[model samples]
Target: TRRHRCRTSASQCSFCEEYILWFSIAQDILKYISPRDEIKLPELELPNINELKQQQLKQQQQLLQQQQQQTLLQSARSSSKPKFTIEMSSGGDNQSTSSSLSLNNEEEVPANMNTIAPVPAAAVAAASTTPELKVENNPDAGIWITSQGVFYFKLNTLHIHLQFFYSVLKELDRIIDIDALYYLLCCLKLLILNDECLETAAKDNRGFLSYCLEKLLVPHIWKIFALGHGHLNECCVPLLLHALNYEPGKTALWNILERDFSSAHWKVRSSAGTRVIALYSLLKPKLIKNNYNVLSVLAYAFLNLITSIEDVEPTVSQKAMCSLETLGDASFKTVMCALEFQFDTVINDRSIILHRLSKLYTILLRNNSTIKILSWEFFLNRFDTLSIESQISMEESGELISPQSIGGFNTESEHFIRKLNQIRFAMAKTDSIKPISSSIRVPSHQRRTTTTVPRQTNVTSDKVETDSIGSFLSPETENSDRSTLQLLVNLLMKFMMKDDQNQVNDDRIMLKQQVTSNI
Candidate 1:
């Protein structure tokens, strides 16, 4: 009963009057720390190893006696010191002896070299005269190396797992070489548990990681950044990031972000930051969000992607970011929209897609950006009715729970709440910044650049065009319902896609008609 009562920690004691004696024993075995205490390493007293030395000395004495007896018997008939003494007797001058010993004095010489004396002339004659037989166990002087898992068998070192990627690169049959790259990615994912190891891996992966980073992870993120697609097979980005021990995305993942990611793309190689953001996004990028340098790069990366590229993929990135805002509860839709700056023709379709934007807000819940995004009142309006009891059922069935509707109890929304919540030190910076509504505005040229009611992109058209952003909603939405603005934008994008499909079908029809006419 007493033993059962003692459960968790050895430091605490569990006792009743019935178990007083057992409690006393537990107290003796288990020590408790007081608040003021600074526990030191236990002073353990191990038996002195001098006894082993003594035993060895005794064996050596017996060996010496036996040798001497043989020597005396042999000397009665002949005479000689042993063979090693002879081999060491390279009898040049004292200069040669000094030189041999002093050779490579980068470190101290072996002790035995100093102790061994020159061989007697008789010992030299022992081999030359009668072919002296010699034997030795070679127990005293040498090192033994063996492999234990990923690391060399060096018990003194604290390294738990260490293996080079190159070694594994050369595959051998039936041998599983340690994958340092995958291992490192794992280390990064467990950063919360192994932060020290994560940092170490970023450094160790410097050489080979670049090759994989460039060839694999970089492309994946860029595809996601610019293209918004990735295959979750073989090596998933999550697995790689986990092994890297990088914090979850948005936690400043760029700290371990590869500088060479740009080498894979002409655009990336053209500007290094482009590749980094692409690569950064692959690790889910939430890890490195706290880092100032990374944050700046992220901002720049967003600008480069949408402004210059005229493709559906750039729109995908914007869409993904909007979804991302949903995870964190922040409204990065504006920032993502801002990245659309500098585009030559402000394609009305690409300007905004409400479904995509709403998706961004949802994914925000999953990103490090989630908490920051959620601070807005816009998000709070979604689900305001459920109590805690209903909330549990909602979670069980994979139902929805909007951060906003959790009660809408607050007087002020997230934007206003956070503005004042910022540190007093940031007052100056805050004062200089304008509200999102005030700063964001469409340009006159942006209005002028509008083409006829944007139509769906007809890729099937034989007419060659360098670029296109399928058709979009009409400009007439200027008078549309404010609540439906998002829906209007989304519907336009859908229309563009549908137009692309129709163009493909129409081309098939015209081709069929032409073939029949020719026949």
Candidate 2:
């Protein structure tokens, strides 16, 4: 074999050509996404042909009437005048003077000229009206007038292909290529950067923008995030925020956010928590308008945030805590309602329940404004009832109540109870002051009657249980100390029974093995 050198260069490669073509297409797409200036003209009402003709006829009639009046006046004046004549000097002079007099009479013909002047006014009106009629009749004039009194000069070329763009956005998920998807998203973002383009896209088809947002944009962007393409999320956030301008889009965006908040992935939950805070900031003004839908969404968001605060993942929990703080700073009344609503619902975890109640109490204490003392008193009464029920269950089970028995009970709950006692003490001290009505009102759906489950017992025992737990300060504080103790005792009893069963099963298995060895 003979040694040979290749003469081909990298610039001439097919891949290089493809890259250049791609770049050119990308540039063209960007240029296409940019909005072109549209010229809007004021609506011009065209003069009706029949109306113009009537106006001309009226002008002509008026001119004729004036001419008749002038003729009558001229005839009357001429009849009122006497005719006079003078002798000429010679025949030739008389002929010259007669020609000169005829020229002067022709020059003094202003009366006929005045009558002719009004005729052109009619002609002028007709001339002015003709162009408008011709404009109305002509096809090439490029002006269109709708019955709504709007004038359309010309259609934008981009508008013709808007549906195609929307379809592409709708089908964005079907695109598998990363570069292609990124390019498409970039182009879409550029399109959204132009307010006019967004308006046109919204008006192009009813609910199309919202459908794309709810079904396409949100899910796809979240999918990309799930696939580890976080940078794409940045590109999509602006589009999502802009979608808030549409009513359907607003609802759709909120639904997606609510769904994502409950996602199994911690990262998704964290992102949703942050987005919720941002959305609340954006919608704070609308919340003031008392829109029922908006308030409902806000209530849901608050509930999600509260749940996320107890998330196992630190990242998500921290985000939720920060979000709650942000919301509290913005509107305390809304947060208060959400807390109360959560408390009213079924929560299995005693620690989480106490944590939320403590948070609510903290909020109430921080609030300097006079709130309904009765609401606080009502909660205290409920706590007193729960404490009594737990004590009755504990006594029925014959479990001893002690600090050591509860496995070194939660100091946080004790401290929270101490704070609650302080509040109660303050209320007692202010017995003379009338309770102010609460400015915050919980929604109807959140309201429920507190009904106690009656325990099976003799009438005298039931009466004694009720009487023993009736006092707010002594029973609630005592129950607060022993509530955790009661919970631990139950769990311990269940664990002991489970361990005994397990040991018995193991012993039976060992005996079977020994019998098999002997055989």
Candidate 3:
């Protein structure tokens, strides 16, 4: 009974302490009120303090439990950080051993934490001497395609891969399996020509790819060109041709033309001509002016076109002419140079040469005033060297027309003047001189080379009188300089007919001098 009374007194003492705390809080609040206010105070009733003491004790215990749980959670987070471990073990069988393995707990921990299996002693022993198994990260790993079994390159190491590829490609010639080799070629076609592969991912690596193709693939490609009857030409040449569209592959393209234009297969030779034509068709003037060295080297390939122009095969020669014609007046200078060098050797083919010369001359005179003036200077300087029959023919044909007629220009000359005027007007409008005056400036070396012809005094009157028309003008260019020059000559003829004998002799001599000067 005495012990129970002591416990009740202890409980009462706890409630007294809580009551004191509440009474102090009430006093602090009343201090904020005004003393003069007539406010009525409500009757204060405190809860049974002894019972409240028990509830407060229970809440205190629950808070302490929550604090303990929080500490446990913090401890769990610390364990999750990287763990490093070192273990040493001694073994029996007359051998002493020490072994260790660092486990990344984050990855190695089992899902059922309680069920983690122990590492075998043998495994641990082996692991101690073994090097750390490194996992290398492949930058290109993302490009692997499993279904098609191909790797699309991201081009990070494209040059290195191409070097290795070219090395392997060099060994393909030794491969005994023809079928496998052919299949490899087909695979290369697809890999190198894929639009995304060529123009997108590998665009910057074009130079390396082009070099590889030239050094390794081009020899085999030439074989295909020579074999003309096979599917190889259709398959492989086109692949290399497509590559040539890019700047880097132009070397391989040029090599193909250089090597194959003389190919035994007529079809291959004709195809070479066609390719040259196509290449020149796409030429921009900027490229012609800026890339002079490359164009000079490429010009070596055009000699094949020149010789082929006289080839026995009409089909082949026609293709060559078509290409030469595309070069416009630029070809005029080249062909004239060639003719000057090879004229003696080509005497047997003179008619054919003359025909081609006439075509080129007419083409140039129609488009370029510089070539027109230069060619006229050249023909006049060489007049005496030509036969009398040839001279008369030229006069009738209007090929040797005088320059005085330029002011009273014909329809063709009028068209040319109109074009020149348009160019000048365009330049004036833009206030830029780059368009017309200097666009196709001829090189100084291509200007007319001076030739001296002795005066033609030993002439027959019949030779001067007979003017057999030559085939110089095409129907499209009807109002040629010839017609204009003829009109001038006709006026001189009537002037001679009306003059008296003494005046006739003087006027005739003057007329001859005028005609000679014009020529």
Candidate topping TM-score: 2
Candidate 3 at residue 486, lDDT? 36
lDDT of 1 by residue, 393-412 (tens): 34434664422224324425
Distance from true position, residue 248, model 1, in Å?
16
CA lDDT of every candidate: 0.32, 0.45, 0.40
Best by lDDT: 2
The TM-score between candidate 3 and the true structure equals: 0.26
Q: Which residue pairs collide, candidate 2?
A: none
What local lDDT score does residue 353 receive in model 2, on the 0 to 100 scale? 37
Better of 1 and 3 by lDDT: 3
Instruction: Please provide, for model 2 over 1-519, each residue's C-alpha lDDT reduced to its tens digit, 9 standing for 90 to 100.
Output: 122222474334454445445744864766575665422211222233345557778989999999999889778766764333233334577775776676557646864354211223244445447975232311123232211121223234236555445555664666554555666676666666543455665675333344455556656664654443545556664565455444555456555755676576777777776665554443323233322233434455555655565566777776666555544344555444433332322122233334443443344345432322113223433354344344434543565352111112232465334323322322222221111111112233222233111121122232333333333224434543344334323323333433345545654575455434433
lDDT of 3 at 78: 65
Tens digit of per-residue lDDT, candidate 3, span 1-519? 011122464344554444445434533443333132322112121123344556778989999999999788667756774432222223442232211223334434553253123333344445446679222222244232211122334434565434434443564455333333455454455445432234432455433454445555655555544433344444564454444444444555555665566566667777776655444433433323312223332343444455455555678767676566555454444434334222212222222333334444444445443332123223332221122223333454687652222212242454333323322232123221111111112233222233111111112211333232323333432233233223323323433443246654654575456445544
Ranked by lDDT from best down, the candidates are 2, 3, 1
Give me the displacement of residue 279 in model 3, in angstroms.
13
Candidate 1: misplaced stretches above 4 Å? Answer: 1-196, 199-236, 239-300, 310-519
